[model samples]
Target: MPSRSCPRLALLALAATLALASPPAARACSVCGCGDPQLDASDPAAASGRFRLQLASEYLSMDAGTEGAPGSTDHLKQVSLRADAVWSPAEWLSLLARVPYVRKDLTTTGPGAQGPGSSLSGLGDAELGARITLLSRVDLGRGRSHGLALTGGASLPTGSNDARRGGERLDEHGQLGTGSFGPYAGLHYAFSQGDWYAFASVTGRFHTVNGFGYQYGEALLWTAEAQYRLGQRVAVSLGLDGREAWADLDHGLAVESTGGLVLAASPAAYLSVGGGMWLGVRAQLPFYARLRGEQSVGPVLVGGVQYQAL
Candidate 1:
């Protein structure tokens, strides 16, 4: 154990460095919601006529790290906290609502460490949806079963609009809201047997023109996940998700470098406590980004606590 200390220390040092690194400047984007594990809407663990409340936090850093301030840098950062509530009216139907608060920071250095930095923080769009289990678990004989579900939702424009700084409007990434309503639909499938589980989902968001005459591109999202139960109190999961967004439109015309595809990998873990309480954490890395122009999105880290009726 004595020899392991050095490697651990090195890793910590690297993480610290990454934390301080500034990310490239980008527009504020609240479209990317919390990296919730996309679990089955109709959780088998919860009985019908129950409520589940989940609270979560996330943070991400972007751009290049600087040893210290005093040099020019272009980076962005995001932090958010969210609450998700689910109500199951019956075994096959669930209603969901998600509310989030977000804070965004961007730094664009001019000369030395003395550069321009922009900050925006406020409530994000709220989402309301319903999920129905079209097919519940079907025993395949041999400790195996599968389920299917459908989900539909809408996002309300309830946050502050972009703030003008000296005759310039900060991009969407800098604004608190899109100033438009968004609607979405999705399908979910799950399979489980013994200690292993698998899930897949496909979702799409249809964006509408906001008050600013700008609209984020429509987004198509999909996720595939697999999990393994380690003992009774612990479960670990891995998933990959991809998003393809059509180019954003400004004044009804496509904006340069406004749309493309982004793919990420998520590794997560859950710890169950007594009384139907649990803790979950997940990390996402954007391994692939294909955009029209110069664009960048930071990594995302998520942690949450939840309580469900047994």
Candidate 2:
């Protein structure tokens, strides 16, 4: 009887050990909206749902001089903070919201010297939108996938337009808040492997200015990015962006382009650190810039954090 009891106890212990050694299922990839498309489709873990949040900040400064004052020049500085959250309900559906806070200051000198002057404050504008993946990897081919996403949304007028205008009247084009309805759209494509990823997308927005007197017609924007995994926990990317804006008021339209490199390190599977730069065209132009022969260019720095909830 003692020998029979010992055999039963040994069997139970072996079964428990096997169960503890099995790995947990992989959580979905909510950060990119579309899961890693480069992985095998038969893997159940690749189709799971995920939630993501991201926060980013940027700083920019520009200075220009005129021939009359020779040494005299004008300068502007701007700081921006942005946050985004997204929920993936299905492999083909996602909802997103974004908020932005901005601060700006301007200084000028020459004949009418007003001494050095500055204004520092916030300009409020927040946006909400939804995105749908019309096509997934399954629709493309076996082992290969392509995703099509369409986003629609609006920006709420929340920033103060009168924060620091100094004594000079604010131009409608210079005000921070549009005080009117704005619409935007985006399209994206991604190709993924077990852990590597590449993507490209284009986004556009149309703005109808409010009583403040600015006219922002329609703008076209586009971006392309490629990324590779350094190991199981790190990924780095390079990207380029281009934009053309049409002004309805005095500042006509301006064309700007930017290119940058991004470095992202995932200490854990769900958290990441990212930083990049915008090395290209930066400008504020009067509608008829081409006619006036005026152009502005500069560089910007950007940094951010991303968190995903499994």
Candidate 3:
């Protein structure tokens, strides 16, 4: 039988997973850029749990820089609803999948614009992946442990690539999907000593050209955080997350303003509501952004719930 004390570790893992998985939907650029892969320190082999589910929502609003025309208003607001599932079939391995529903509103300030804004809602790209624990150590008497794992996955082009508004074709960046497949790989490490925990990871996503002869830039994503368990039912964390990307390619030509670097401060809290359920919220405030050409970025807010089913 799995230990009921697992909720403490389960809550930590839930908060960590939510923080890592929410950023990909928060970007204001053409490509989804970068975000953390879904993996954490919870040890299923240690009698934590065998299966879990998470539901989360992410929100971001951004304004474009004045590059094309004077007195032009280009702003974007996006909200994503994501459902993630994790299954631990073996002690050393975990399999996961994610599905997303996206809604976007783009408002432009310009002459001859179609209405005040355009809105689109649809299913986004879905992902499938696994995590392999490479090493695990535990000291039962000291209540200290650490683990290292390898994580990788791919995103499927399940959403529509070509979307039109007012009979006008939307730009690739404005489309609901990339229309191409993406593969990603990363490494994760976590350490816990008593009520204090630390985590870090780096992931890279490789992009391919779509049928439209457009390829999004490859992205590098990373995160580092520290969490403190206040008691059996509460925890708080603070960390830094960031991304770097190469310029995107369009018909073998680099697209201007398509790639850059962004770094943010993340603070989060989690609470156990009892019966294997946990609630968490995180805020990502971009303190630094440097983009090519004319582009701007904004903060992201995320909230979610996790349930341990098995």
Alpha-carbon TM-score of each model against the true structure: 0.81, 0.63, 0.88
Residue 176 CA displacement from its true place in model 3, Å = 1.4
Q: Which residue pairs in candidate 2 have backbone atoms (N, alpha carbon, C) closer than 3 angstroms, thus clashing?
A: 38-192, 124-159, 250-287, 251-286, 251-287, 252-286, 252-287, 252-288
Candidate with the greatest lDDT versus the true structure: 3
* Candidate 3, 1-310: lDDT as tens digits: 2233433543554542443433332222434444465543333322335787888888877665333355554677778888887777777888888888988887766763446566889998887888889998988887777888898888889878888877876766667788998898889887877667777889888878988998888888888877777767777888788888777788989865567788878777888787777788888777887777666777778888887765
Candidate 2 residue lDDT tens string, 1-310: 1222221121111110100010101000000111111111111111237565556565555443422244454455667676666566676666656666767565656663355555555644666676667676642233344566665666677755553345765423234555666677767666554334445556566666565454444545544444444442333444444444443332333312111111111111111232211111111111111211122334444455544455
Order of all candidates by lDDT, from best down to worst?
3, 1, 2
Q: Which is better, 1 or 3, measured by lDDT? A: 3
Question: Comparing candidate 2 with candidate 3, which one achieves the higher TM-score?
Answer: 3
- Candidate 3 lDDT at 160 equals 84
Model 2: which ten-residue window has the lowest total lDDT? Answer: 22-31
Instruction: Kindly provide the TM-score of model 2 when superposed on the true structure, using C-alpha atoms.
Output: 0.63
Q: Which runs of model 3 end up more than 4 angstroms from their true locations?
A: 1-10, 13-35, 39-49, 65-73, 111-115
lDDT of each: 0.62, 0.40, 0.70
What digit string (tens of lDDT, one per residue) describes model 1 on residues 127-166?
7888778987566466666778887878789877767667
